[model samples]
Target chain A: MSTTIKVARPVDWTGIFFAVVLTLVIVVPLLVVGTWAFTNVWRFPSVIPQEFGLKFWYQTLARADVWSSITMSLTLATTVTLISAVICLPAAYAFARMDFPGRDILFFSFLAGHAFPKFGLLVAIAGIFLQLNLIGTFWGVVLIQLVGTLLFMIWIPVAAFQSVDRRMEEAARDVGASPFRVFWSITLPQAGPTIAAALLLSFVGTFYETEGAWLIGAPQVRTLPVLMISFINNQPVIQYGAVLSVLLWVPSFIALLFARRVVNSGSFAKGFGA
Target chain B: MSVLTIKDVTKLFPGGTKAVDSFSLEVADGELVCLLGPSGSGKSTLLRMVGGFETPSAGLIAIDGEDITRMPPEKRPTGMVFQSHALWTHMDVFKNLAFGLKLRRLPATEIKRKVEAVLELVGLGGYGSRRVTQLSGGQQQRVALARSLVLEPKILLLDEPFASLDQHLRERLREEVRDIQQRVGITTLFVTHGQDEALSMADRIVVMRDGGTEQIDRPDVVYRNPQTPFVAGFIGTMNLLEGTVANGIFTRASFSHPLAVADGPATLAIRPEALDVTPAEPGAAKVHRVTDYGTHGLLDLDLPDDTRLKAMVSHPAQYRHGMGVNLTPRAVSAYRNNAQIFRSEA
Candidate 1:
């Protein structure tokens, strides 16, 4: 008997099309900025740089204001990540494990905080900060950034804590660990990846935040992104801004790489039941 | 030896649902007592209270005459095995076993030795480095047991630790758990809905229903002499028939079990295995259905009273469906107003 073989398609064409579109949308801008960072001169309609060199990269790194901007951005991002994580731990725990009157309402309020448009809220916050004479201060910038990142940080860890089995906590307690120990050993370890993701997101959010720093810390405190925008307004220094933007992209890329493994490990309960 | 005592323990959950009501029991050290009941019967809730996971609304739980009712779980000297085994996924088998030992600040050498010994005890001696997720269900269960066992707790609370395993594994693990409990001689409180688990493993089975203790007795006694209709029906397959007691005879539509000295509205209880099915010239019952298991068969008989009685017969194929047969109960229990008033001779 003769059999006719029909070849099957190897890939989903529609999905491939969407993926290609998304990759181009995300990757083309990075490629353009990267090219510009090394370009000496590239006018409109120029597909590639007319002259290539590392002068912009060195200038972006060596400038005193740029150096301080980098330092200030690092400090702000680190502070935001640390504070967001510390403050959200207990709040997330309450949201995940407790059932009191107004618990849902309080959680929903946090969600609403996250949902509110940052630009509109920033204008109001800037006015308030100006009235309080808090503008142009480091703490003032941090406070505003905290308002933007707090809800996101809490929202993530709440899901992380909720995914964990309460029985595991109870088991830890049964084995003679104190409640705080249970939180540290069992609850916190189980939520490691999710917390890492949240912190990374918080750091990235703060480091690249332009409006918050511009509105709250302008001239006095110029973070990397705000400094990038400042460079953009100058005709000769725009390439340096592209270099700075690419420099700011490094930590976030590294974070993404680490997050993929941490989130997927899901090692919390290898054989342990959900 | 730890003697765990629960006195007047009542757990009233939010919304006024009584998960455990005025429950009390005494368990001597090394005794493995099982709480057997259906779901929502408060077995797990009672065990949680004993483990100090849930505070009793009103009552006292004392272990070895020391009141531990208000103590936190960490200070209560109890180790619990959750139903899902609840082994920490972040830790390997050795770390899981050594967790409690580390908390106690035992020396490194002592913790290592104790962990290895417990792993060996649970038949997992060489699995110390393996992640818990790498182990099979049965192996993970052994790790959970070992984790608790290495703690050397005064009381071990097991909440259906083997409930998730397949039938063969469940059977093997139940025996292994019982063996381990015997060797360790720790006072244990086991909770399970499976009657077979309770019957085969428990020294005394505390049968519960609707937040109340139905009967507490030796497995043989509980199986043979269930005190309440609920216990009889819940613990095993029981043929319950409603009848009235008059003229020293308890009579259903056509079925009768003699009551030597009682009269009232009554319920007749007979184990399916206790009733014998045979062909009779004047048989008043017809076989409605036959379900054949490997070792025995269950015959559903339709009686004149419109009540269908289940009878276990060894040779099921000999009696066809709709076949005329007579059911003679070799042993029986009679309940008056839900309480047993009569038990037949063995």
Candidate 2:
């Protein structure tokens, strides 16, 4: 009889340290918010809530205003994802495969939006949105979200498409595939997951956006982040804000899982090299 | 009529590099021509222009007497095997082969038949269902070949297709490619930097250098009677000796030969195999180095005047370093300022 033996891998201390740090930095906050959403009465520096109930989660869900904010944020995020993907695909393709005068400078300029804090830029753009009568409108928030996500979508696929082999497209063309067909069949398929990653990243970015959504989407068209901010300021307890935060975190967590899967699939370059 | 004709083609890149310059060649139907050159010699650029991947800055390309210079690659009737094989990693073998036929809107039955036929032709009859990533390098190469040939293109262009394989596999694959090409009788333009590959595979060879055509002729003629010094030196190793030709007699400082050609200040080019070396008590040449392969060896010798000569010897074990040896030219090719003046009769 033959038996199989399982071998154990040595513990990675550095990885474990990073994992713990990440959990503390990210997961612990979510857990605290979730606990706060259920706690009827809780105090900081106390390990557990003195009292517990579902009143805050129930109240937040039943609010017509909260429902409207959720709906508006969802619509704005979907619109931004669609628009940014459409605009970023061609821009990324050109940056990856073509050469033009001042190309690097132009591409770098696309990334210049990240050099400064968004709060500063939103403050300056608030005046323009005000003059255009776009402040507090759904389109106004969507426009700001599109600009924020375009930099990410364009940059991600540019690096992804550059990693894709140019010879595949050339081979497709040699075998009678048109420019459109070559992109549809070769370039897009090879970089499909990366493009997906970009879209999900854009969706997540727009979903969690606070500064621009607060500055541009307040009062008239209340997005989730704006409502949560107002709730936190107006209410003495943090439970209502924690309830809204947990609701918003759900879709972002799902998007992150999908992006991680797309990245870890790692099957794009399997047959190219020996 | 020629199947393909490139007339005065020149490709000037954006940064002032002339990748291909004034290159012209006519490929007849069912003829396999090899473009042989070192790297950066513009051989690939010429092939790309034919395949429509590149557009020549100046000149025209025509197929079957119709101008295709302005046509896009997909509209041209050509197939190319890339150096990297470029198989679709995400696709199964069948999907990869059926992609072009599907683009052409062929019927399912016809696509299946053609795909199966080419799969069998390339010796991969049952490989259609396999994922490309699971296949070996040689298998992937065949799949790449089958993918292109299934389309039945009017012309086939191969760009160093076997460069990535092991040496043994490369030799076998190259022979398989030659056999398939001949059996199909497709007009082929093969690009290679290897002289041995060009010599073995091409019906006619086009020797290129510095984005220009050096010589274009049959393999035997290009080898036996090169038109220029560059062609002679580039095709294989050749020793260049400076001399003067007068009244059908060529004379060097310490050697003389009776030629049957014109008189001028000339350069003599002799291939290593054309020089006969033998041991002598007192000889003008002294053996400097000897490198032996299993079948043959190379003897690098120097004359008293500091002229270095290399000769191939069949009896490699008999030669040693710093030994005195006598050399006699069995045949010599004379070139005057890059133009061929004469070659000794065989």
Candidate 3:
């Protein structure tokens, strides 16, 4: 009898092809945006920009409204994140660790924020906000942004808290630690990484949110994304819109870096039940 | 003096299931009593009640004559070693052991000294700085034990601490835990489902069934003189023959035993070692199978009345399948209505 030996292939062409396709799908648009942010003149039929300078960057930075919009976006996002965390985190813990009547129904109700078309929900809430004289106010924008954060702040942290080992808490209690002490020392530290990741995601999502801010804070509360819409709509120079777009990516880019660290530490997957 | 006392404690869950039913126990200052049972036997629930993790529907738990039935777990002067070890993954071994001590307002130097002493006692002398997540299963369990022992709690409750390990590791850790318990001389209540664990380690074993205790006695007494039929069938291999006792003789079909008891329907329980098996022509029983287990052997015998019995033979090489064998009971216990009525001398 003769024996046959087969060698394994070294390179997988199918994998390589998909990798290149995916990279182009994500990177191509960002590359075009980067190119337009610096281009001063680009004529027709040119593969690359015909002229490049810092004129648009100087113009966007010199405007006082641009700086106020930047400040407004940060303040609104920070406020929304802080208030949502305070309101939602304890509720998440209770939903995760305690058993009560109507627990599942109450927990899944947070999904109502994202279940339907968000604009439809916004339009409905905007009617109520107008009736309450909350339109064109900071708190109105804050309340609307809070709707977007409920799912992340409640669902992800609930999973994080649920994944913590109950036995560890029991061990702490058995060895003379109070209930509050056990939560602070044992439970919180274990769930901290995943909760931090969720917070960052909520902040970045609220920062880039446009529809709510534009509808509720049209006259007074001008956020970065709201201002970016105006720049894209009314400004004659395309570079003005491109520069704001690039500036808008800054916080998200930093948050992505921090989120990657959190994911790499191995808690992000646990937060989503992966 | 008894260090811990539990009186008529019961736990009725919300669904009306009685997990524990008026269980009572008393432990001396340095005694190790094991609550042994299968699943749903309420051993763990009883242990949890002692640890103050569960409130009894009706009972009183006291340590040193002070009622602690309503006190929370943290104030109960007890420490528990869970089956999962439950070591904090974020802390090193030193911090894990020192946490309870720090909470007691002990000085940092005193905490360090106590932690080091316990670490040495559990045989992990210099593993204080290693992260708990990096340790092996046995080492993590030792850290858990050390964590509880450092507090010097009035009672130590272990709920199947070695249940998750492999067989070899389980035996070794069982001996180690018993040695540490004796050396420290702490009142300990250990709960386990393994018969070997309860038999070899406990000063007295509480055999539980269906939310209540069947027997509470020393290991040898529980093994040799099981008061109830459940304990007999649960603790070890026993040949239970259904028969009737009449005029000092227990008779079942063609087989009979000389048992001194009242005339009634009875269950004759005899250990495998107590039955002697010998080759004979036209015997009452036939050797159905023989298994040689290196140190000893087991013989499965079939009686003429279709009754199956097990007997231990020291020399199995002399017996063959289909051979006629005679069974003689060296000792036996007779039970009526699930309770013992008579026992024979060896």
Candidate 4:
């Protein structure tokens, strides 16, 4: 008779440990904030809230200033995404396909938006906005937000366009489609998914952008992130800040859902030049 | 009537390298001409020039007697099939075929009819609704061919269309393409590096080397009467012997043959089948290797001065390695300064 020795599988302790740490890192903050948003009274030394209700939610939603800021943020994000797409997509295509003098240098210059300390750059741009009499205007907010969008709009779409197969375009041309028709029919559709992913990133990034809006549109335009900063600083109630913080996460959460679908479609990786 | 004429078309890339230099070709109506050469031999560049994907640095290109030298590819009445199928993955097979016709603003019914007919012709009749990515490699290639043929262009250019397929598929597809070209009666220009493909498919093979024409002849003529040493060496297996031809005789180290040529230094090229080998004692050449390929056998022989020669024989089992053999030239083509000087009849 042959004896069979049973082998015991080793537990992945390191993997489990890291998974627990990561889960706590992400979930604990949200859990604490959520608790604060609902709590009416959680005095010092109390491990848990003594009283919890919907009072903070009602108070945050009732403010006219919070309502205006929400509207302003949405409008700025939408406008900036649209304008950035219109201007930067064409530039991205050219950067990907065409050759010209100093093209490499010029394309890399879009990175200047995020390469420096953004607040310092925003202060410098605020000086120009002041001289141009553009300070405290919505267009000033739009222009500054546009700067935040350039890296996502240009770099990602450039990768998307570059990944498109050129032979497909030539095949279209051989079939009697003009250059413009080939681009419309062949090139754009092939690059569409990745470009869509880039647009999502640009819109979500613009929505959460704070420095440009605060520096340029102060006292006139207050986006949600800018409003949340003030709410945290001035508001005596901790629930108001917590409520605003949760509100700030709404667009990002929704964007993440859409982003998952886009990533699953496999174009998101190509947009990052994978 | 010639459907396409390329006269002295040359492509000098910006770096001053001439990819196609003073190349000229004329394709008869309904004829299939092949530009045959090794890579970098400018066969594809010439095809691209005709298809308008490339501009010739100098010279003229015409289709049906109209100059299309400066015409864009879309404006030119020419269709090209690339080596890669280049099918639009976003569209189904049906939409891919219909796209060109729709651009020409053909009626919807007519577009459907034409697309369906071409699909049938390419043996993909019921594959119209299938996504391009779902089909096999050979199916994608057929779709590519169907896409070009449905346009009914004045000239068709194929740049190594069967190059990506396996050997068996390549042979089958080349025969199918040749059949379709004949059935459609469309003038075609095929560029390929496979000599077997050129010999089997082309009505005329244009042998090219170093961006220039070496020989242009019928397949049989190109095989039998190669005009240049490059063509002789490239088209098939040939045993080249360095020798001198004088007084109606060719002579090398220990071998001599009767020839009629004005001779100085000359290279003699002979096909393996054209050399007759006989077993002999203490012969000038010794059998080095023998390979039996079922239908025919190949014998590799080494001369006294170590010049190796290959001969195709009907019976390879009779010759043993290290055995002595005498070689007799049944037919030979002599070349002088890269050009064929004389070819003796068997």
* TM-score versus the correct structure, for each prediction: 0.92, 0.88, 0.92, 0.93
TM-score (0 to 1) for chain B of model 2: 0.93
Which is the leading candidate under TM-score? 4
Of all true interface contacts, what fraction is found in model 1?
Answer: 0.86
Error of 1 at B205 (Å): 1.0
Worst 10 residues of 3 chain B by lDDT: B253-262
- Poorest 10 consecutive residues of model 1 chain B by lDDT? B254-263
**Local error of candidate 2 at residue A254 (angstroms):** 4.2
Clash pairs of candidate 1? A270-B133, A271-B133
Worst 10 residues of 2 chain B by lDDT: B251-260
lDDT of 3 by residue, A76-185 (tens): 99999999999988888888899999987887788888889989888999999999999999999999999899988988888788888999999999988998899889
- The residue ranges of model 3 lying beyond 4 angstroms of the native Cα positions read A1-28, A52-55, A127-134, A253-274
Q: What tens-digit string does per-residue lDDT give for candidate 1 at A206-238? A: 888888889999879989888788778875657
The residue pairs in collision within model 2 are: none
DockQ of 4: 0.82
TM-score for candidate 4, residues paired by index: 0.93
lDDT of 1 by residue, B175-229 (tens): 9999999999999999999999999999999999999999999999999999999
Which candidate model has the greater DockQ, 1 or 3?
Answer: 3
lDDT of each: 0.87, 0.87, 0.91, 0.90
